[model samples]
Target: MYDVSPVQLLIIAAAGLITSVIGGVAGYGTGALMPLVLVPIVGAEPVVPIIALSAIFNNVSRATLFRDLVDWRRVRLVILPALPTCALGAWGYTLLDGRGALVVIGSMLVLSVPLRRTLKGRGVTLGNGALATSAAGWGVLVGGTSGAGIILISLLMAAGLEGAAVIATDAAVSTVMGVLKFGVFGVSGVITAQVVAVGLLMGVIAVPGAWLAKRLTERLPLRVHTAILDAVVITGGAAMLFRAATF
Candidate 1:
């Protein structure tokens, strides 16, 4: 039971499925949205580790579905340079107390709105050297955070990937980083039987989400959905910061 009430477990499962569908349509959701539920139910420290494990399922599915579109060259460019700092960042996350964890996750969630917009609109292209260097910085941020995958998607696009290529590349990159995060948390002794159980349940429920999202993508005006989601994220993030300050 992972020490959770059945309702809490249900909430986690619902979050996984809802966020998965949101992610399938939007290219980023689980990382941004999952923390809103997980933080309250499990406390702040476990949020990143739980999401790190659950995300492996989400990203790996996207990678497989879009495997043909993945740019191996860009994957290589981003992954290698990112590994070291990713580890450093993951390790740093382990050191945060509950309040610190809440602030970090909340602040990132709040800023992700403008940061994602700015990166998406960033018309400047990157050369290989610059892309790799930028990825190193991305590694640090992503390693420690849940919602930073949007940054990776933007990076891929700015590096000349378009359409399916960007999604495919981001999924592949995130799969690897997700594994790296799990390993770092595992080594740091954050992994537990409860973590594995909850993460698996969430993943299994989410596995079919992309297919469901395909049906909704056409009817759902992405602009409207995105705007609404942005509002929710900002509100949820600010709430977390408030909780952190008062806790």
Candidate 2:
């Protein structure tokens, strides 16, 4: 377990609080942003599990706040394939070195931006089968990495969801994925006492952030939300890559 000073603890909690607000709006910024703060403090080895554990609280808050808006059909579509595939990804995560996992996580975030813009411009749409296949791929990445939520947001947007529905549905799916990751990491001995403690603290502190985001979402324009999301993804991904390279 890595020892954290009170100041570092404050930083981590603050990160959760801040990112959860963005996540509440975008359905993704927490995972994309939190690691940029965490990996350096705790090192890469425990960051994924820590974030996964913390995400349970963050997602639950969003899912609950936006319960009425959740697209259950889309939730089922993503979760069905993600269930088995995410387990496989978690298993795979156990085999990767810290640098490899960080690189993968970083690369996924960076690449997803261009991919999202391209797909948006092309106006590509996925049918059920294709959507399921894409969910499976996301399952693997999300199970193993820190920033795969952006990809899910893109997929949901492409599937015709907008505004609250996108955030709500993504939260529902992500909540389940977080539970799955927690179990896998727990059983695999990846979740240590320090991880649990930090995760719980961060999660609790983020609750208000989620509430705040819900309020903001009602007023925020979709175009503004999209722009902020892209900026965060790019910056977070670049930071992770820089850390991995230096490591």
Candidate 3:
């Protein structure tokens, strides 16, 4: 169905599987990593749409698997304000050209590393009002980019969620937001047959990742995992920036 060679298809599947596992363990991975693989093959324009559709699959799996742990109140807080902003961001994304798309994606990925660290280190607590306001801003950021899930996860953590609750809540909120973003993309005329084909393929491959991540989360410390992931994200982001400059 794809013009991509079998090897590239295999690479996509492998990246999905690996990132799914990472996302499962860390509360975010597929968004950050998938863009690295997808941009090279599909170009930057389709990368977010591809991941946006696939995320409905990834987030739903986590939400379902961690259903009991979800804090629906937090989900509601994030969702209400994020919806409109998210739609706006997706529409803005549709306005970008290939190089602009690469720059946007790469800059977000790069900025996420330090932003995550700063948020975690401060361990800042957001009151409900602040949380809602923050979610409003976050909607615009995540709606347009692939790697900004870390912002949502950290936002949940600051609002008094930890461990499985954070993952579950993030997943639940993400699923809803994903649907909204997908609708925006569909109506904007960016949702192509290949986007559907690749998204579905990645989604199915990523579904089992949550269960596996559950097993690993209980046993692993995640410091190493986080460190390695940070390196990869930075490397990938830098590479994308380089390509953007050269392009």
Candidate 4:
């Protein structure tokens, strides 16, 4: 029931386009940026809905662009754990205030980097139990923070997936995660007509941006692509911290 101005709608659309490109090229970071920027524009109540919708669009774009390279096995590993924990996190989010939720989410984002780096290339093959536990943890974290892609990206990289495969599988998993989060938000009364309308408008623009990113991805060197992703992760993590503190 929130009323968005024409200028605000345009801003949201532009943010969506930019976030899609970042998500498409980097495999993460879009969600981290969404709540940070949109919360102030639309207020905290609509932030999760906007983020969920944007995520749904982002994943759809990524899935469409990299359909051929998706790794089903990797996707399973992340989704298995993420689904349930995300639900729990979403439920918790509905009960908490924006600042409280942001604090929790922001801390997770900042902590995930060190966690990923320490765990990176360690050859720690996750069994069923480990996978489920990690997924639940990530889901809860992502449900609150909107950065579900972070854990999955790190796991995929550590699992030794190549460039296209990593992006494709991550996108596929994000699609599922986004759907779950959207449902949770909808049921919690967080998603409204205005939020959906603005989100869908943004989604329309995101498709092209994602496609452009995919084309760009093809031209970049592997190291350069990875560096870009790393930068996004670090920058996003920092942004989350700043937002949590200030807001």
Candidate 5:
């Protein structure tokens, strides 16, 4: 059911190990990094499903690792709006061509960095209603694309969730999103045996990476963490945009 060569599988395993660690620390990396590897192997059509499937394990690990810090209130706020919109977004994703979705994902990623910084500098924040409204919009984007977790990270940061709180809350919300996306994909016949098998394999291999990140999160300075997250988001976003443009 899967087309990946043994060599490609090896490469994916390595990427999975690395990106999971990054996800553990930054609250979002697996989705951003996996597509860079998966798109060429699985093609664009399956990349989102694959990411969504694997993400169930990835976020589960992170949420568990950071369970002590997760803000259940924020999780509730984000999930309430994100759930219904995500279903719509998944349906909408079936309508978009590969390049169209890539363009949307890339644009959102690139724009999010500056948007976040500007908001922080001015002390701007969203009330619950505004947050729910924004979550509705993000639900659509995330449902359709890989690497869209940065959107949630940005939203959480804007809402005054700093450092560990941001990662923990993002993880909780992403866990639910992962489950929702999986259901949508499964019902749509997008989740094949190969996808599930590969996703689970990568997920198990990624556990150590999350463990390492969990240890580091406590030691890393807040500004350093923020900078790393921003840099990764921008670089990943730029890569997506470049790929989309070339495609």
Candidate 6:
């Protein structure tokens, strides 16, 4: 376990609050920001569990705020394909080094935007087998990379979801993904007691931040919120690529 100073803890808490707000509003940015912000403070080895915990807390808050807007049909569409694949990816993650995983994750982040745009307005019907395969791909990718939520969110947006429905359903699906990832991390011995404590402390800060963002999203202009979300995603993707190159 790495030792975090009081000042560093404060910084992390502040970052967590900001991350939570972005995630609550957009349902994507927090996970992407976690590695960039927390790894230096807590050390790289501890980042995975911290991200997993934060994802769970962030999604929980988003789900609560937009419970009424959740789209079960779309949620099922993504998860049915993503869950099993995520588990397999998680298993593979434990067997591989961080650098290899980072390369794949970074590439995925960079490509996700164009991929989403290409699929937009296609109206491809996803049957059970197709859904499962897609979900599995997402899961594996998510399990391997810290920013899977961004890819999933882009796909959902491309599928024509809007407003609270997108946020709520994304939160619901992320909740499941986070929980499963947490279990995988535990089984892989990556989640230590110190890591859990720090993650939970960060989560406590995230809850209020998520609530504030949810309230703001209710009142703010949709274009402004979406613009901010897009900026965050682009920033995150760039950061991931940088890390892949340097780490």
Q: After superposition, which runs of candidate 4 have C-alpha atoms over 4 Å from their true positions?
A: 1-3, 121-129, 221-247
Query: Candidate 2 regions off by >4 Å?
Result: 221-225
Q: List, residue by residue over 41-72, the lDDT tens digit for candidate 5.
A: 76666777777888888888888988999989
lDDT, candidate 4, 59-98, per-residue tens = 8878877999998876787788788888888877778676
- Cα lDDT, model 4, residue 170: 85
Clashes per model (N, Cα, C within 3 A): 0, 0, 0, 1, 0, 5
Q: Per-residue lDDT tens digits of candidate 3, residues 1-247?
A: 2367778888999899889999998999899999999987888999999999899999999899999999998888899999999999999999999999999999999999999899989888898899999999999999999899999888888999899889989999999989999999999999999999889989999898777888887887789989999999989999999999999
lDDT of each: 0.85, 0.85, 0.91, 0.73, 0.80, 0.74
What is the overall TM-score of model 3 with all chains considered together? Answer: 0.98
Candidate 6 accuracy as TM-score: 0.84
Distance (Å) between predicted and true CA of 159, model 3? 0.8
Q: What is the C-alpha RMSD of each candidate to the true structure, in Å?
A: 1.7, 1.6, 1.3, 2.9, 2.5, 2.9
Best lDDT among the predictions, by candidate number: 3
Candidate order, TM-score descending: 3, 1, 2, 5, 4, 6
lDDT of 1 by residue, 50-137 (tens): 8888888988887787789889999999999999999999999999999999998998889988887887676867889999999999
Q: Better model by TM-score, 3 or 6?
A: 3
Supply the global lDDT for candidate 1: 0.85
- lDDT for model 3, please: 0.91
In model 3, which runs have C-alpha deviations exceeding 4 angstroms?
Answer: none
The residue-level lDDT of candidate 1 at 94 comes to 94
What would the per-residue lDDT of candidate 6 be over residues 10-44, giving only the tens digit for each residue? 88888889878877876666776666667556655
